[model samples]
Target: MQYLFRLSAIYVRHRRLALAFFCLLQAQAAVAGDLFHTDNADLYSRAFAVVPAAISGDTQLKFGDTPPNLRLRNSLIIGTGAALVAVYGSNNWWQSGFGGGFDTTNEGWFGSGTKFGGADKLGHAYINYAGVRLLTPLFESAGNNRDDSLSLALWSSLGIYTAVEVVDGFSHNWKFSPQDAIANVSGAVLGVALETHPGLDAMFDFRIDYRRSPRSPKFDPFGDYSAQKYLFVVKADGFASLRENSFLRYFEIAAGYGTGGYDTGGNHQRSTYAGLSLNLSRLLADDAYGGHMHATAFQRGTDRLFDLVQFPTIGYARRSLD
Candidate 1:
């Protein structure tokens, strides 16, 4: 019991680090599935380029707050791994007659469809929220500038969305949903807008809407033919940091709104789902060689444990000390 309490306290202290690390790692590993395919590399590259330029206003790339890493190799490993996972999992789901498709809505991010419906599939939006929260923190840690983080988030989101589209583009069960990709990028950009542009704070936030329709090509061929009505959720979330001095480590919080319900043709019915989006991530270590390590462990104990146990095991011993 003592150990449990100690662990709890430890986690409390390092919660931000744990959360950030885990989320970034998850985003790095899981979210890239739809971002890396070659079907439209040129278009994607251009789309990705537009985001950084638009968001940052400078030509510099937003590669996280961390320094120096090979772009191509890093993107490939993250992208390919995510794509394969999506494909493998997608195939498994398709066998059960679950072919994913795009939403048809103008209200989404940049006017794209990304909703998925059908009663049993309500939890998919949760997966997307997890990804966004995890990825968003990667941008929050910078001293003040979030444009880079926002740009990186959108770029990564687009990369994953594209990869999924590419895989679907070739598959027999689903066609590439470029519109969905647009929605994703737009949603990510919206997230950035909320963070960077204070004016949007009152009007915008993180949102997820899922729909399953019989008339839509992506779902009609499967099996059930009823005009299936599912759920639509909207959330307004943000992340901020608290600094005491240059020495005391950084603190952060991510908060948002979530709402959903069944949308039966004529009018979209709804449900109330309000929650907070909170996460705390900090830099674990910075090296003289332009290299650094970071983690998002959510509690002080876990954060410390990561520093003590995981650090030595991974040759990042210095992070533990930091």
Candidate 2:
């Protein structure tokens, strides 16, 4: 975690590294699957998945849902891995000029000195982190116990990224960076750890916030570092005691890092922030959801959405590090 914080101190220059990272926010709805047993889209999707189901049929999931046993031969697990490899190869790599004989690039520095302001390292981490969280539930939903699911997610996430790096080692446009590997490993481990432990999962979230860069002629959430903020948060609702504290429940501690002006010409700026962050999802999920606010399906989606993306909220203590 300390290493993660240190590396995060340098994300003002984040740009898109994978199409997967670009899809992560939307991936929540697809990947979370039957974990929450939510209604509407979730229910419809669940039914569609079972019309000729590869494994199981519709079922309600409880917060206390227990895993039965591990299932190694699962279609979802294998399909997800193959999809990642195929999408990565086709989207960012394996293109015309993107291929070449083995080569390397000495990418380094977690500051302004590195390519793309070293913020792309966070991109590496974010991809793997999102990968683990997205896949763990799929594994468990396929009948693997939590421990087995987490373990598979960790290894699969690492393997997928490592494979991408190996391809980059032979690519024409990019090179494999030890820095990226470090970030990838850090994210995979952290993802599994948080999923393995509920207390930690509730307390902290590694999330990225983004808006299209004004300099860009079109909206580009993937490559716009000027408007991207990577946030590490500790929510007050993590504690049962704090959860009962009405006023304190929606407040949280947020530490964030990002680069600005990178999207604008050469006028680069780096910033880091720490202070109170409002948990708007919690506000919507708990106190403000009419009366059926006890883990309703809407609350499930909101919680997952907030976990993956840091929605805009009023805050204080933001400061420029550069």
Candidate 3:
């Protein structure tokens, strides 16, 4: 009886510590399992698997065949991409040409006519969407699950674009634009939505084309009206639910608009275009081409190559001066 009583006393004295130790074990197991499975599992398995293993000193747990420094690799990829954008794409913001004073005044809806009739806003949205979409696969390769990858990509794009806006605000030549910020957010949301439903990717695409304009204070791609055309393309292949037809599937419709002569003291001319476009991805889809035109390196290279050549389209123009 005395021995039993002593045993009970010991158990009571150590109860809290034992409970804490068990909880610690559970936490470690959960962390290990998440790390392991995120790097290895398929969609179905990732959704359902959460079994916690017992933590034994002799038990070895491996997080797939990934290097022990997977986090470092992810950081490097993100950092490199950010550095490139900051250095080349946004170098104008850091240059001494613009006065050093910050502009806190928000440019109501359309920024100081410098954005070339909302072309810059559309550019912002396109950047945000493309940034998130591009970063998502990198995040996934870096060990994040699909949901986490999408979240990270969205936040990362927002962060980069917000940083750009902050730099713009401080520049003497540019003021903060609420319209641009809204467009950026909208694009990020669209990117996340598309990523969650990849089937929708074929349905919508944001494309941009640029041409040199003779009337502009500076040759800025983002600000120059004479140089930018933003297109929202709807691919017919995206209508997979509406009975697949061979002829219609290879076509796309695009509506694009841009403006010029914003800074040149002339009337801001708007260019609206509507035209039939080819769905190169759908047209090239064949067993020989691996049917993954959207995901292949060859397809991406072709896209970049073709982007240099602006396709001809029929459009209407409003306002007189160029």
TM-score of each: 0.35, 0.70, 0.67
- Greater-TM-score candidate between 2 and 3: 2
User: lDDT of model 2 at residue 282?
Assistant: 75
Tens digit of per-residue lDDT, candidate 1, span 1-322: 9999999866643543333233334556533324322223344355344333244446454654332222433455445546554544344423332224433223232111223222222222223333444444443342213444454455555555454445444444555454555545555554455546654442233333223453444542112212322112111221222232333323221222221222223332222232322112134332221212232334433332321111111110111100
Model 1 spans > 4 angstroms off: 1-77, 80-88, 91-133, 139-146, 198-322
| Alpha carbon lDDT of each predicted model | 0.36, 0.66, 0.61
lDDT of 1 at 40: 35
> Candidate 3, TM-score vs. the true structure?
0.67
Clashes of 2: 2
Candidate 2 TM-score to native:
0.70
lDDT of 2: 0.66
Q: Please tell me which predicted candidate would have the highest lDDT against the true structure.
A: 2
TM-score of 1: 0.35
